[model samples]
Target: MKNEFKGLIVQGDKKFSIKNAKTDYTGGYNKEKAKDALVNSKIEIDHLQEKLYASGTYSLLIIFQAMDAAGKDSAIEHVMSGLNPQGCQVFSFKVPTSEEYEHDFLWRHYKALPERGRIGIHNRSHYENVLVCKVHPEYILSENIPGFTDIKKINKDFWKQRYQSIRNFEEHLTANGTVILKFFLNVSKDEQKQRFLDRIEDPTKNWKFSSGDIKERALWDDYMKAYEDAINETSTADSPWHIIPADKKWFARLAISEIIEDKLKSLNIKFPVLDELEQSKLAETKNILLTE
Candidate 1:
């Protein structure tokens, strides 16, 4: 697992460049290789999840962000399938309700954070403040931050402030025993178009497609710029973003699994220790069982 696919990102250097950051990773999606990686990652993550649960030392928060048809749900399902259900929870965020709109932007997100010794996965997260809100500035009006009515100033500072806020929030979580792993599934526009077309053609998947998806795709460049800015600004050491190559489903799954496995391994978690007295008691119980 260590050497199977290190630095696998095909255009990773360019995409990660500070000067001209890009969000496309279509070149690294090898279906056969990805399957092997995913298999190994599943074993590692499962073992780590058990240790994390037993030791009760830390919690994990995984965030996934992607455009429509970028396979966020499928990624979560496949990558997390091996984990103990009792030790993990998944939250899918949607458009805010009236009640949600009444509170601060992070309030609803804060409510879904994982408890001690568990993993929480967010399909979309508080990043909406910078991504979706950047695209649709009117959404900021719903946040109701004081003096935010001035569109000009709000546009200028909203995303920068939100980026700082997210950094601070994640740092606070880390200080309080949380390990956050964020992934921005980078899908190509052509792949997305193919996926949308598949959804339209298939009866079972038709429900997932909507006219709004096309409308959203029309603003593709705007969203890409917003994404790049958000990632560059908010990706700190405490809560770094893994820009996953997601043009292919299998490769996307493998990258996600690898990132998760790496995060869990970094915690150095181990199975709970039993004292000598407890070990002796367990031996005695084993003897009794043999006699019976």
Candidate 2:
């Protein structure tokens, strides 16, 4: 199932175009079918996560990036539903705080990385520095970077440098036992409009809508270009990007679970073996407990 979506995974300096991508793909899968698959995936993920936690051999870092109303939150909530809370950490990055701006863009992300045996999820991650900031170059001024007093001086090279930095960062993590899985939820513009309308019409979902989302929607094309470039530049064999067709939330969730399970399986994770002495100690403890 994971291989079925390899086309969705950006690779090898490919020229990516959001216009050429699909946002409602289901690969002949229906919602009911996808839900069943998701249930199985959740069960396996629960078991794999237990082994991953107990083995203490590797960590998983899942990064989600998408436009507003693209279902990043729900996807994370559902696909990670069965994970142990003790082995999972989720962080949603909004605007950079004053203290965050004090350091480099990737600093906070590095600090938030999962420890060995845990899974860390980033709702909107370090990729924002290149995506949103690229779309709105004016946002660069807020970073307080050295020698950039003039925002207009921020040139194409600035973005290139950031992309290189991101690639280096991911490679470093991969070398140190963290498996990186990046998902770009590719929701269509019309679908986004409909979702926005749903949020407006549904009183319970009112809090999810924001005027700022509308403002950002106005720059949809620019954002798409930014995503294309960023995905193309940073997606490597070690930390590849999966451009998920997110209009159909059920399919998207199922695809995400499949991809996650595939990665976990590839890690060959297993529970740690007890030494002979440890096994003897365990037997002694069991005898004592039974006698008690």
Name the candidate that leads on TM-score.
2
Error of 1 at 54 (Å): 0.7
| Whole-structure CA lDDT of model 1 | 0.82
Residue-by-residue lDDT tens digits, candidate 2, 1-292: 4555777888755767889999988978899999998999999999999999999989999999999999999999999989999999999998988999999899999999999999999999999999999988898998888988788788988888989999999999999999999999999999999999999999999999999999999999999999999998988878889999999999999999998988899888878999999999999999999999
Worst 10 residues of 2 by lDDT: 1-10
Across residues 102-132, which tens digit of lDDT does each residue of candidate 1 receive? Answer: 9988889999999989999999999987888
Q: RMSD per prediction, one decimal?
A: 3.2, 1.1
Off by over 4 Å in 1: 1-29, 276-292
TM-score of each: 0.89, 0.97
Positional deviation of residue 138's Cα in model 2 after best superposition, in angstroms = 1.2
Candidate 2: global Cα-lDDT? 0.92
Compared with the true structure, all predictions reach lDDT values of 0.82, 0.92
Q: Model 1: clashing residue pairs?
A: none
